[model samples]
Target: MKEDAFCEEGDIVLADASEDVDDIGKAIEIVDIGGQRLVSGLHTILASRIDHRIVVGFGAYLYASSGVRKQIQQRAQGAKVLGISKTQLAEVELAYPTEAREQQKIAHCLSSLDEVIGLESHKLDALKNLKKGLMQQLFPQDVA
Candidate 1:
């Protein structure tokens, strides 16, 4: 009953082989034949598509856009999705400045913020461990 198995690079996966289509949607990189499994970034359709749209299936709608998030949430509400119908998902609506440079700047700023948060988290963990070690040395324990 081991869950969360990892796939190695360059692995070829077969379609409809998974017990759950939702798991296949999230774990596998691509699907073919209108719903067959394929390696991520190696498939023809995905590679050719230029839109920034992300595909989501049933039980796997958690990874979908925030717009449709509410609808999916209403259906399952914390339960993993099993499969999502094509009609259930819709195109995402994003509002951004017309200038390409401004868009790039915004994206860069957000990315930098994420990196800073990650580094701060690591530093905080290290500091907490150091404080625990110091407390252990400062406190005396009675031995019987």
Candidate 2:
């Protein structure tokens, strides 16, 4: 079975203890539907702000201030997973800004970044194709 087969939507995931732990602490939101025992490749990072209690999904980063962590720990008592209940998921406190306009601005900035990254990727692909064509012309090879 694929590694993802074990995960379900809304389930808090802990990185496999055996894998590299660098990006293991972050939680991810599943965006695709898979079988009861199937794994999927689509996921987004779950992030929240401490002072402002704002929960958001990020592309590759998740953040929670120390205060948020403490709150989650306090509430995690008796929280059971597969068969264990431990303070594994970090807690985050989020606060919504009173001004809707400001919130929109923040979201816009992040969206802009995503767009820029996508455009840059396309440009890189075009450049690679151009180089391949040039190389083929510069050094034509014949097969016998």
- Model 1 lDDT, residue 52, Cα: 26
* Candidate 1: segments with Cα more than 4 A from true spot: 1-83, 91-99, 140-142
Candidate 2 wrong stretches, greater than 4 Å: 1-18, 27-86, 91-103
TM-score (all chains, Cα) for each model: 0.44, 0.45
State the lDDT of candidate 1 residue by residue for 1-144, as single tens digits: 122132222222222122343332232232234544333332111112123232211112223335334343333212342443323322323233555466456556655876999999999999999999998888857545
Top lDDT model: 2
**Least well predicted 10-residue stretch by lDDT in candidate 2:** 77-86
Each candidate's lDDT (Cα)? Answer: 0.37, 0.44
Residue pairs in clash, model 1 = 57-84, 58-81, 58-82, 58-83, 58-84, 59-81, 59-82, 59-83
lDDT for model 2 comes to: 0.44
